[model samples]
Target: MNEMINRRKLLQAGGALIVTFSLPMARAATPAAEKTLSPARVDGFLAVAHDGTVTVYSGKVDLGTGVRTALTQIVADELDVPMNQVTIIEGDTALTPDQGTTSGSFSIQNGGMQLRRAAATARRALLRRAAAQMDRDISTLLIRNGVVTAAGGEGLPIGSLVEPTALALDIEKDAPQKAPGDYTVVGKPVRRLDIPDKVDGRFTFMQDFTVPGMLHGRVVRPSGFGATLVSYDESSIADIPGIVKIVRISNFLGVLAKSEWSAIKAAEQLKVTWSSWSDLPDQSKIWEHVRNTPVVHDDVTSRLGSSRAVLGAAPRKLRSTYDFAIHTHGSIGPSCAVATFTDGKLTCWTASQATHDLRKQLAAMLALSDADVRCVYVEGAGCYGRNGHEDAAADAALLARAAGTPVRVQWMRADEHGWDPKGPPTLLDMRAGVDPQGNLAAWESELFVPDGSATFVPLTGAELAGLNSLGKLSPGGVLNDLSIPYDIPNVTTTAHRLQSTPLRPAWIRSPGRLQNTFANESFLDEIAASIGADPLDIRLQHLEDARGKELLERLAKLSKWRERREPDRNAEVVTGRGLAYVKYELVRTYVGAVADVEINRKTGALAVKRFYVAHDCGQIINPDGLRNQIEGCVVQTVSRILKEEVTFDRSMVTSLDWASYPILTFPEIPEIVIDLIDRPQEVPWGGGEPTCAVVPSAIAGAVFEATGVRLRSVPFTPRKVLAVLRAS
Candidate 1:
């Protein structure tokens, strides 16, 4: 297909419409060929057609987070237009601007605001046109649902006032935006735009997308980490009916076939020898490795009084070390991508969250200019953070270039589990001192984490090919929430960035905030248990932020929290309630959670019976969408805290399937209650990740209350629980 036809096809497939318009309404229509979208211009974000349909272009994509609908709401409300008239196209390197990656829950907080401002600028420009056309004062014209009405009852549709071309207008920073009190759609519980098609399987995912004359490709990975391909016998796959070619660059080996099944068969049948290296540490001793690894530098995130001196002199002191295991994204459907190389230009259809960045990386890999590479986003399996999608795209680009044809690369389950970037292991040492009146006088924490340089997260296929890969590290955010949020008199927090880590690391959901909050909140609960105080009450005493205090108080009422009484350790089964709170990253969203857990002392099985959450994310865009995000956070994080861990031997990951790295099953999910505090007057934060930061700590507190054994480590496995019980 030609470029224009391809652009139209992409928009239609993504459930968006292509529209064009220019500013001032009276300007002559520019030739469609000459029109270009620029991020700095209002036209880049919004377009209007003769039919009055509004098409929005956003760089932030919706990875099943419902931002597609939430962003539409922001634009619809700001422009005084009906939601049905708005359509959003996202994450297309050629169409959308570079709004950065869609991680850290910034889609709504940052990206949404950009769209809102653009819409407001468009509205102002349109109103001026209407006033001039009707010979009326600007203040006398009112717009509602794309119709401008004057005081004399004369009205005009917005379509009649605009040219059918690019807006070509610069965005006005001080454009007047509709007051929140006047919003008719933004805060309402509107249904998500992409949900129905997804539910009925009508939506086209990246795996299902294809270009004409596409060959199926599968990469052959080594059996263990740090292994290099010595040689491959391609003749072994000659009998495979549809086997076309085998492409190998250095250690990167891949098979292309007429069909996907043939590619898979050929890949499995190809005989290959590889060089092995034992560089990974033992999984059991990973925490020890983290502690012993040389520190690149210690970052003092927060400091108050002299914590070391106060802790040394304090009458009562508590010290404990907590560690979180490595975790994979474990996307239900493995990553998939399609790439084509034509006329020395590359176009890739992928599911990467950062398409613009992927385009840059691919351009660099192929030694092409950025203008020659285009990355288009098609929704795939939900990956909360950076995963294998980008690597899969890289694989397709390489094979497509070699075969001189379009190639579709679909990662096998093993490829996904074995090679996807992992959430790096985190080890934390926490110390606190209690004052004479049972108040916390001092708090100190030291975090052992890897260098979270996202730019260095290497592409597996590129690295194997011996190309210019960024590096081996895939570290995620590791310094967020390093310091406790409570009002401790003497407090200090330090993060020791390790020069190296055992596995490829990448951000997963809440990233560093989740692990750091787990240690901080759980340690606070441990102190409360030691001093015979209610967990919720203790948090309330130290929390100085009004929003945080209100959130915790609301959580107590929601969960019907009661003071913890001494548990009967001799009982065969017991139940207890525990609380945790976090001001996400110590600045953004505020969340408080309470978990009710049931434990079988005999088998050491732990089940969360119920969970309650109180969330304050400043403003509400779509109540239903926000609730959905919060609920998803609670369920997924419960799995992480109770079962999810990337199991590995000395060389490579051993857990390659669901049977090995199990997740929280539907039957295991607990009943969840959520209360959202919406402040329309406040700026909207994010709903995607704040609630996740509290799940682990709340569950840990509940486990401690039930068994009176503080479970500092994550994924409190049955063996670990039983061992602690037997020793006690």
Candidate 2:
């Protein structure tokens, strides 16, 4: 069977309707050779059928962020169709345009806008056809519920205008879009499309997907990083039932079996010898290592007046150092993928956020043309950033090619927690000066961070197999918000890009903004405490952006923020509220947060009681979905700040299970209240990561208020808290 035809059949079998453009329509275009995946083409994004149902093709997959429904809302509103009449297909290399990775919360901001333009173009074309067919002026026709009607009540279904053909027109750069005030669906709190299937256990996650005659496979990783496989004894797993094949290429090793359990047993029982490597620095002194690492180059992100001169002339100056611990994606489910190679073409079903990029990587690893590889997206574990999904896809592809059959690879828990690329540790040094009148004078900050972003994180299986991979280290884009958002007399910020880090680095949500904002906002609070000023008041005084100031004020009103006074040192248990704000990336979304916390002086135990957030991302697509993202961001960031950390020795990671690396529990969740500010006339920004940037700083500020001890490091365990308390 033809691979493209086979893929369509598979999609149809999975309950999705696949519509193809007619030959006549394809031939009607000015350029007959125009690519089907062209982002500028209307047919690439939208397909209309005789039954009036519309199909939308998008390259950006939803990573459990509810973007699937949100994108649908954008299309429905712009195309004047019922939301239910539209269905979307996402992240198929052969089916959807390459909209790049679904990271940085750009799915709606970038990809949805592209689709919206395409939909608008299609709507315009359809309206023209309807006008010609009904002998009415185009301006006198209105589309409602996918039906074009004239002022005389004569109407035609949208499907009738484009039956047996495609919308072969190019997308108009200035296509007409529905006004915000006229929208009836885009901003509404429509229920998520994936929720019902997920709740009822009917959603087909990547782990549940399968191909005919597929074998179960599992990769065997080396004992530690940089370890080289010397030998493996296949006879060791001879007694294992259903063993199919043992694939060993260079340092890469894996086992295939007739069943999933058989693959697991065979992989675990197989004997392998490997050379050892212990180059990682001690975790206890990771901060020192980060500070001392050789600098590749200095990125002067922001510089205003002469900070050195102002600080020298100021009366009082304060300095503080802060660090964030390494973290894992901690996906609830392990990564999984299924792959098959037939007639020199490989097809893979994966949950990778960047399927198009994965397709290229897999093709390079296999030494095949890009056109010969196809990557299909299936919902799987929610990886907020790059995790093991792409690696698992590579593993499945390699094993499938070797075994001469379809193969499914599922990563074990240990594999996920121990081997997945980590969110690298971050260190920042902050300095601020206050004038004689107790006003801010100067501010300076320097960040010691990894040299690259997630774009450089290599494919694990390819790297292990001695195939093509980007041999560079990255901790995502942490350079964001290195420059503070506050308006000050003299300000300077620089990031010292480190040549090496303690572990293989990848992006884990908000990336650099989360870490930098933690330092920026918390240090602002430290300055406030030093000068006996209210945290909220100090932020408001320094902020100049109208939107940022409004967000802070709204946060105060929502949280019922009160001015702080001197702490009672004699109290046994103390309660305090702290404030933090961020203009994410210093330009995009704006967020303000308040954290209420309680602490026990005796045990040095801190408990967050509540969180109040004020968020403004310009325009709102789905208010309910935006709220869910903010709630999840708060919960997860709380986990990252209070509990999560990846432990490692010189040779390998030691935190391989939940007990070793704890996350926040359900019982520990705090009451969360959010006030969303909608600016309908302005362009929509990202909602996924903006709110997370404030979480750590807010919690840190709250911890400081509850106890006069500042938490300069993350994962504030009781031991660290107690040690700081005793030292204070």
Candidate 3:
């Protein structure tokens, strides 16, 4: 390995970038040659080794999205090999060139496309080579089971023709991808390749990775944001049993021991002093702060006409404010990282989404070259953008480098819950003017928040300064709601960035789309109600595009929503229906409306009996995987809407564990019916996030329909619901 420089900086072309790099040869070949080859693969290799095993390397991570199965199918389809012949290697920094991270629902949308194209090109190259070797026409060479047969029954398996070194094949940069009509395996509902191990408990997540002679480590993260370690007494920990060493490296304090339990226990026993925040900042104050922040661009850069004039002159208008709370990814397994340093090189195994970035960060922290750091994948815990596997992995590497031994660090549930950076609290203030005839004359919304993608971690001193001053700039969030698909005469939305206590945010599943969609969809519901309109009908009235229509059509058909009776008819409970839809990136779009929710009038208990969602994300890779992703989104969103929050007093997190920051258990999980629109020809979109955008709104809307009371904030806990009911 060569010394590693910051390869990331070299790749960034600036401004919300998406990059794709192809190996030279077939994939990047000229258009004339690219078309001459077989068309089953796109961006990856499908080859027979000397031993006759078929290997496929993918640029996308499984991330539990079934990219492994999807990519394998492409290879199997293109190479005319059985599924059993293929072996998939994914998200390893050492072996694979840098594909982008796995976030943004781009795994199959972008990465799958690349792999499919590459595999197709390789299959063609091999067949071309086979024809030459056999002195036969390429068209007549039949490829099946890794063998090529001639018209006269002369045949040879691909493995027989292998050179000492494997022939390298590249993908065409602009090769016309195999369309859905030509797809042999992509759009089908194939079983997952990673499922067997997962079901049999044979899979190894990062937490499961272990090394010979590796010591366990735990870092004493400050208990609060902005809390610095002024001093610590390690004297007490030094005498603890199994303690290997206590070390302070630059800014972090760590304890290394023979076992994870011993290290954690010893570290907990040591008393440390931390600088706490001077004041208490609760949910209300944070929401208020967000609401009061100035709007960045008043005109809101819209194609609509003069919203200001229409809103100001309108005879009657409705305006309201909505709040969203913080939530964690709450992955099934906790976060852990294992790293070893030897010969001035570090090797780490983790299930992180961003391998290239992880390698860079580890290298920089250890003062090593990018080549000196290698990141490989273990099965990962769930990552909702909150999974800090990269941070934990880097921490382990830094600790291992300092202690002169390999280290595995596992974050306890409390440590994971309390210390992980959260999705920022958001505030939306929307005001709309509707004409007497129920036409939306004007609409305006002001959104406030800091940049979610500003830094990998929350801002420190210098980073904080830069972020606060740049708060006037765009904070990089989704804005689908602001742009009404309806041909409204006047509509404008403005976003203002407010520097919050130097906190860093990243792309959670839906990030900007979640809060913005909640506000927009909920407000649209309110507008529909104010006009005495059916929520679905009103939405249909406004939807002008084909994608929007397709989503609505699918949603209506799957939910059987149109034939259902009125929400108020279920007098036993407050039952109502609500709808939400969004276009997340150009690759995929979805529209979903939920039904069946009840709020107990007496005890303030809430029961989401069932939810029906319809999604249209172009091609379906795995029906089961898509369904699982949507269901996971539903469960995750329920946690956010019902009971999960990170509270702070004096900048110190008070809800510190699973007990305090609750996740949705099986008991609380509602029945979710997911329907995928089978438009395989359309661009494939992400399913994980689109459903999340509208969950809170659907719940809130259902509660409103049931009880005529509204939930103005997230985590519509019992107390908030009771308070609203009592007031009503």
Give TM per candidate: 0.96, 0.96, 0.88
Write the residue-wise lDDT of candidate 2 on 1-728 in tens digits.
Answer: 45456544555533333654432121111111333788889988888887788889899998999999999999999888899999988888777889999999898889988998998888888999999999999999999999999999999999888854448778998878888998889888999999999999988888788766789999999998899999999999999899999999898899999999999999899999999889889988898888889999999999889899999888999999999999999898999998888777787889999988888888889999888887888888678898989889999999999988889999999989998888999999999999999988899999999897546468788888999854367688889988888889899999999998888889899999999999999999989988998888898888888899888888888988875555666688888777899998887899999988877888977778899999999899999999999999999998898888999999999999999999889989999999999998988888999888998888888877777789888888777778898999
Cα-based lDDT for every prediction: 0.85, 0.86, 0.68
Candidate 2's C-alpha runs over 4 A off are 1-9, 13-17, 20-35, 163-166, 454-456, 563-569
lDDT minimum window of 10 residues, candidate 3: 10-19
lDDT of 1 by residue, 1-728 (tens): 46556644544554333555322211111112333457778877888777888888899999988999999999988888899998888887666778889999999999999998898888888889999999999999988998988998899888788874435788889999988889999899999998899899888888788766789999998877789888999889989998889999988999999999999999999999999777889777887788889998889999999999989988999999999989999998899998878778887889999988888788878888887887878988768899899999999999999998889999999989999998989999999998887778999999999865665468888888878655546576779999878898999999999998888788888889999999999899888888988888888888889888888888888887865466775789988777899998888999999998988999989899899999999989999999999999999999988898998887799999999999999999999999999999999999999999999989888887788887877888787778887877
Better of 1 and 3 by lDDT: 1
Comparing 2 and 3 on lDDT, the stronger one: 2
| Candidate 2 worst ten-residue window by lDDT | 23-32
lDDT of 1 at 238: 88
Q: Judging by lDDT against the true structure, name the best candidate.
A: 2
RMSD of each: 3.2, 3.0, 7.0
